[model samples]
Target: MQSTDVTQRFLFDNADARGQLVSLELAYREVLAKHDYPEPIRALLGEMLAASVLLSTAIKFDGLLILQARSSGPLSTLMVECSSDQELRGIARYADDITGDDLTDLMPDGVLAITIDPDDGQRYQGIVPLEGGTLAGALEGYFANSEQLPTQFRLVADGRVARGFMLQSLPPDRQTDPEQRAATWEHLSILANTLSAEELISLDNQTVLRRLYHEEDIRLFDSGPVIFKCSCSAERSGNAIVSLGREDALALLDERGGEVAVDCQFCNASYRFDRDALEELFEAAEERARGLH
Candidate 1:
């Protein structure tokens, strides 16, 4: 059996290609436990969570990778974030009594946005129309249009387990031959296309790769854990309260029976602040401001 809640990277020694496999068990259950989402919402959120981790490993960033889907249909919003360290969290908002299974039926005019937020640099976002009726298909369009890379994604979820596989063509610095590159890419994609959702979700990483690329030279690396960890903290929440400014914050606190409450939508974690706590937060903020001057 495959290791639960981990991502493993692989490379093709014979071709300029690379891939990663992600399996989410405990982490996915943790996210689902936070919200009572509909069946479709749960499944889509699982896929998004798997996708975020897979994308995070492919990118060379030391921050967060966020995948968000928004629409006006039954499934209104879905968001998943994965950090460089493989911490994951996700949430979904949808209408009740949702019966639709296809993306077009659930999110008719939806848009998928992939945002890269680096720890010490500017942020970048790419938006793509939700096409091909599946998250995998829409992401393929995102790569085809925005990144111009030959990439393939296999994402599957059954509300209990979420798993994803990604195959991408590396830059042609070593291959340098267009025809050979195309041939190698086509070969890998053809083999990957033969992979069934059931097989990908059920098989172990070594078994899956052996079944698909038994004849190819591939290297599998050590796996890293993927966990469900909310980035929200009392300090961040305190900063948000301070962002409201002193007078308004105090007035809001007074209206809320001398205490203010904050609930994180992602993890359902609650943070509360009384008048004294609020005063201290603002004082610290002011002191920091004065020090900066």
Candidate 2:
């Protein structure tokens, strides 16, 4: 909220549950900087962006955490990506005027999915029904049913900023004192939920921490920085074109004036490739297949 994306982890000295608080500002603004989105769509992006960071708090992954939603309404797609380092990026696609309401109102029957892709492993996905009133409640239900952990989330997005907090219970074996763990989780959840939009978007990370946990023995960990970044490049675009098959690519490129133009839908960045580029891609694909054999 202090003009930056900051992720902080906190532990309760005498409790079995842990928590994380993540706030955003500059990165959130950067997400909307490249295009002119409608007011409602922008706010929806903020909500999804905040929820992604909050979900990443308790996830143990070293690569990417992608949150996506594809709906049937005028607002079609929304996506937010977070890395182990808390770096984040997001964008939304929707009509200019999208009924003007909250997330549930806009996306009534869509599915919210979170994909965790580790540094060197298979990707795992979890789907959550977008039934509840707020995105926060929907994710809380997700944790309870899928992860089997009592989790609480507080997501706040406004003023072109996105932020959230999460409290997760440890494994039962570690939570020998069930009452204490429950008490600690409730204490933190209440404080986190009471956070104001100003506190989430205007104050620094530590200030927010102190304001929320000053009376408790909450231990703070190393701070992680987050930013808005889309991993789109010319090489990736070329690979995608190659996957489309050389004949089709060549035909399309020929129709488009001897060059292929591809746009990265997430960041709205354009990549252009002339005939030579496609030739090179096909050649490389062939060489890779041969080497594999």
Best by TM-score: 1
Tens digits of lDDT, candidate 2, 30-94: 88887788777777788788778777768877899999987787777888898877777887877
TM-scores, each model vs. reference: 0.97, 0.91
Model 2 has an lDDT value of 0.81
**Tens-digit lDDT track of model 1 for 1-293:** 75589999999987899999999999999999998887877888999999999999988999999999999998899999999999999998888767698788999999999999999999999999999999999998999888889899999999999999999989986588999999889999999999999998899999999999999999999999999999999999999999999999999999999999989999999999999999999999999999999
Off by over 4 Å in 1: 1-3
Report the number of the highest-lDDT candidate: 1
Worst 10 residues of 2 by lDDT: 172-181
TM-score of 2: 0.91
Report clash pairs, candidate 2: none
Local distance difference test, candidate 1: 0.93
Candidate 2 — which residues are off by over 4 angstroms? Answer: 1-3, 172-175
Q: What's the C-alpha lDDT at position 84 in model 2?
A: 78
